[model samples]
Target: MLDLTKLAQQMQGISQQLTLEATATRQRLDRAQLLMAQANERQADLVQMQELWRDRLNFTAAMPLESLDTRIEIAAPPAAHTVIATDGSQIAPSHHEIAYCYLINVGRIILHYGQSKLPLLDSLPEVFYRPEDLYVSRQWGIRTEEWMGYQRTALEAQILAELAQALTDEMEAPTLALTDGSLIYWFLEQLPAEARDRILAPILAAWDQLRAISVPLVGYISASRSGEALNFLRLQSCPYLAPDCMTHCSEVVDRAPCQVLDPLKDAALWAIRLEPGQRSPLWKSSARIQEFYGDHAIHFCYVNVGSEIARVEVPAWVAADEDMLQSALSLVLGQVQKGYGYPVALAEAHNQAVVRGGDRARFFALLEQQMIKAGLRNVGTSYKETRKRGSIA
Candidate 1:
């Protein structure tokens, strides 16, 4: 049981600390604007920074932009456009269980605006028990759940592509497909080469399908922490006098410029700059995985949703198309407005995908019954789990 009085006291103390941090954060944001304003004069520094550390750094255009400023005019979406979103939830494998099993639930919602009565909805929950699905890497003894997350991401993209492909008729309204997080599976870098290849191949296929269909699919990241823009600011502080930093600052410690902007999230940085419905200029990602993206390299932009800022990622094709970009921006903003700062389709999908405590309890009960029927050792509940289940009196 929680100590109510103590918990309240701790929360109050946390509130005070948050207030202090918020004040400091505001000051840092002001300083960030001043530093970013000077990015142009430091173009030579960026060039040097790139030349010295091209392999070490990840940048979209090979060279950091001389200016950190880009603003695109927001255009309203068509009244009859459709927005589809998918979200996923997972149950990780437990060692206490007889068999290593986990579940992935994907929920999809298709919302048609402008007098469309039919809104498609579906949810799929898959259980994996195959030897290949149970273990990620036998050599490393890693759990399959670790890699399943990336697989789920790929599955979501594949589902979106399938849905997009199904829309064969050319309607007046454009259809926009959305997923909850980044399009790039950055975690793939953490996996072994074989694991990465196995997981990424299908996602690559999905990307090709979406690109061939020319459908605008977006990966919406809320409160994004990416700092691709800050890399330019860091370049501005390059201390090297020449195009190569190998000799000058190589031995120096923590000399990157714009350390003042450290820990500032991308959404927070754009919150003050963009108006509601307005979008920042497209910024290409410098992720190493993008080398495999072929013509579908990922790019991102920040959108101002009035209540909060959000980072929206799209493929290079969508980024290059003004009509598609505007439609994505407008529909996303509209979705946020309908959901009160979040997308309604995503919210509904999340609601459908959620796994409640009651659901878990029922699942365990069924598992126990199955084990008993099979004449297998019950391996009764863990002592810790038993204690947690009891009520506090």
Candidate 2:
């Protein structure tokens, strides 16, 4: 038989080693469990923070009604004189095609004029004229290249010159020229020195002449629906106010007292009270806040133009709720259609194809039919066909 005492001692040492190993492994497992629990806690905290942020934003976006006190009154239209509403539209590629469409109405007589640069692509150099009085097409040497900047400048100069000439040629003596937009044209800065001088010199001269003759030179922007101020108000869930009111509010918000307000705080306050189709006018006193606050305090006053009376000054960031995006877009589109007379009827034409069913001949036939319906006489259609060669026998 072996030595019992020696075997017992060896077994005890082995058991001790196994017990130490098991204790170490259990400690490691406990550490891992603690780390996992900490990670889960951090995740929950993050989620809670996000939820709090959203709630805060939503609350600040709620509309505030503190200063809306003015009563609503519809102003009568000003005494109608010879009103001429002129609008200019510019297209890209070759800026040569600058379209200046104007509506001149004196009493019952209405005159519409659209002057555009005739595109001389390839070898054709021509000027197409279509007016209420005369329809004339003449070949004029005008070349346009692919350079957008140079083309834009050249086209603006040409159009401005044409506009000045048209003003003198069409109107007898000095007459009032009422432009449909802002007095200063934004594109004026983009033109070259010579072109700029050429374009503006005559315009200023015309203005001087009009001033001398007591002819009023008025410009009306007609409350642009796409204005940034209006859009911001709409996004903030406050669209009922006039564009000018929103503009004033934006100005105030940028200043001292209002700027200090936490974005989320303001948004929460404004979002709750601001309703759809709500409108308010910011007062002159509020507009002069900079004078009162001395570059420190923020002040805004608004008179409710909407049926409901709620006025709130809020930060822009609070207004950027994701839920407001679609509503803002719809409001903008509606405003654009109502204010700008954008063609809602012809919206389907936006997707209409030039050719359909992969049949070129049929497309031409359909085009001719459309032309005929549009009162074009003696409409003709022609096309070139490609033929495939037969394989050699």
What TM-score against the true fold does each predicted structure earn? 0.86, 0.26
Clash pairs for candidate 1: none
Report clashes for each candidate as comma-separated counts.
0, 26
Tell me the spans in candidate 2 whose CA falls farther than 4 Å from its real position. 1-80, 88-176, 190-192, 222-393
Q: Write one digit per residue (lDDT tens) for candidate 1, span 266-371.
A: 6777888888877776677777777767888888878888787788888888988887778888888888888998988899988877778787667667777887
TM-score of 1: 0.86
lDDT of all predictions: 0.73, 0.30
Candidate 2 lDDT over 1-393, as tens digits, reads 699987887997899998987676555444433432343344344333333443222121112222322222323222221222223222221111112121111111112222232211111111222342111111121222222223333333233233444445444422233333333344545445554454446545544444344334333222222121111122223232222233345445444222222222212222233443333332111222122222222212221223222222211211232223222223222322433443121121111211233433443455558767888785552122211222334
The candidate scoring highest on TM-score is 1
How far out, in Å, is residue 33 in model 1? Answer: 1.8
